[model samples]
Target: MTPIERKLRIFVVEDEALVAMLMEDILLDLGHEVSAIASRLHQACEIAQAGAFDLAILDVNLDGKPSYPIAKTLRERGIPFAFATGYGGMGLEQPFTDVPTLAKPYVSEDVQRLIMGLMPSIP
Candidate 1:
């Protein structure tokens, strides 16, 4: 069966509204339910804690604030996630060194593949 058929739930945290919309569209098209999308680190953390998402797509920087706190919370909850950034490998902080990342301007298929590979049955 296609990965989407499993119906994973994902949360998106991106500072750019347009990018968030595009990511949302891609996730929706993949047949997964988007639990929430937020632009600020505060809002993102709130949603991430409140929502029962299986995974998350985190933007390393939200405005000038780093998303490490949110990423830490996800890690504590045992939720799988990947960084999606425009900064390439230079964007990651030491804490996120081992997590998967996808550079921006990426193909939608990459998002789908990463999600499917990391969280086949939802976390």
Candidate 2:
């Protein structure tokens, strides 16, 4: 018998349009659905609070504003997420040190691997 794979509904929070688009493409190629995208801190916060997603990929900064508020909201909702940043994991503050991070300029395999690791039920 084989296990069935479930597609994940992912929320993306990124300020840069190009980066966001790239992430969307990567996720799609990885067989995941992007539930929503938020390019600003406030919008991201709102989406984090209201959206139903299996997981999220959040940028550490959104147009010079930190994204901790969105992270907090996701945490409150019990949704697991990873940080994507140009500065790698170092871009995250001390409080977020334990979260997984995908460095900037990542490849599709990196994104796929990270997502698979985060959500083991997905194949």
Candidate 3:
């Protein structure tokens, strides 16, 4: 696709360090910038509310809680994001029911596809 021009700022919130790192690497490789990375629901909410990201990839669960609050903030600010989870379709919360998502263990191409799907006009 467009390869995400100009290092599009992205926020990645996943509790698993390895998965978060993998996502960060993928985003960087795609020529996008990782504005911030959070591994907890609270941290994700705070960062999302701070308004620094062009987009986000949020895991459905962070620590022991759902990332719904962060999702709410993203929606409130009109920030586009996709849920990333091992649980796939059944993992999404009510408010994020229709939002785009990526299943865990995703390949780089999977990330690219989801990003493209979320921002189709970008390419």
Candidate 4:
């Protein structure tokens, strides 16, 4: 018998509205629900502080602002997250270098693979 996959509640922080929408669609297709989406650093930080999520996909840069604050909040909350950046992992600072990252223009499989690595039971 096939094991039932867990449906994770995910938080997404992307400054680009279209990118966020695409990610939402992709997450839904992957059988996960997007608990919340924030496009600004302050708003994302607020959501990170107040919301509960299994995981988060954070854009390293939100407009002209950095997403490190939100990442910090998630870290304190014990939530796992991966960075999504157009500039690749090189864009991240030393402190965040060890975190997983997804390069921009990622496909559904890319996201699935990353999340599966983070949560083995996801697939």
Candidate 5:
């Protein structure tokens, strides 16, 4: 069997409506379900702490606020995640510099690649 299930539940932390919609469409086409979408830092953090999902796609910034706190929460929960950013590597800092980053204005392929990378190892 594959390393990942046929369907995954993902949480999205993006402030842009259009971008979130695009991501949702891409994930849906990839046979994944979006458990929740948070547009604010506080909301995202709360969900990160209490939400039930396999992975998360966190935008590097949310309304000028960094999404690192939410990312930290996900890490504490042992959930895998990728940072979505337009600034590329320059936008990341310590602790998250090595995490997979999904560049902005992404296509379905880019998102799919990140999702595949986040899959749990079978071995």
Candidate 6:
């Protein structure tokens, strides 16, 4: 299957309820499954540790705290992920500066691009 045709299990970490729902909706509309949603740093970290999904989109700030720890966990587990932020990838620190990013207020096309970025060989 091609990247557009593959169904990914996506984990979403966003503090804002509406944004989380939006991400989930976009993922669903793209024919992917939302494996889980985390709205806080601690919860998101736990989910990242479990690493249950094929890919993830992480909000940069969760309840005023950075989601870097969750990003670290995802990296350690080797699960592909992208940062979702209004500020874009400039907020990222060392070792994660180059990870894919999905800007805020996303639509289906942005989500599709994110999917392709994370899994270029998704077949």
Best by lDDT: 5
Q: For candidate 2, what is the TM-score?
A: 0.91
Candidate 4 worst ten-residue window by lDDT:
114-123
User: Which digits, one per residue and each the tens of the lDDT, describe model 6 over residues 1-123?
Assistant: 234657889999999999998888888878899999999998888888876689888999898998889989988888888999999788788888998888877788888877977886332
Q: Write the per-residue lDDT of candidate 4 for residues 18-115, one digit (tens) a residue.
A: 99999999898888899999999889998999997889999999998889999888888878899999898977996888889988999888888878
Which residue runs of candidate 6 sit more than 4 Å off their true CA positions?
A: 1-3, 121-123
Colliding pairs, model 5: none
Each prediction's RMSD to truth: 1.9, 3.2, 2.1, 2.9, 2.6, 2.2
lDDT for model 5, please.
0.89
Per-residue lDDT tens digits of candidate 1, residues 1-123?
355647878899999999989999988888888888989988899987777888999998899998999999998888888899888866588878888887898777888778877875353
In order, candidate lDDTs are: 0.85, 0.85, 0.83, 0.87, 0.89, 0.85
- Residues 27-61 of candidate 2 have per-residue lDDT tens digits of 88777899999999888888899898899999998
In model 5, the runs with Cα more than 4 Å from the true position are 1-5, 121-123
Top TM-score hit: 5
lDDT of 4: 0.87
lDDT winner between candidates 5 and 6: 5
TM-score of 5: 0.93
User: What number of backbone clashes does candidate 2 have, counting pairs of residues 3 or more apart or in separate chains?
Assistant: 0
For candidate 3, write residues 1-123 as lDDT tens digits: 555635578899999898989999998888888999999777788899996878899888888798888888988888888898888877576867898889888989999888777775332
The alpha-carbon deviation from the true structure for residue 54 of candidate 2, after best TM-score superposition, in angstroms, is: 0.4
TM-scores, each model vs. reference: 0.91, 0.91, 0.90, 0.92, 0.93, 0.92
Model 1: residues >4 Å from true position, as ranges?
1-5
Task: Point out the worst 10-residue segment of candidate 5 by lDDT.
Answer: 1-10
Query: What shift in Å separates residue 52 of candidate 3 from its native position after superposition?
Result: 1.0
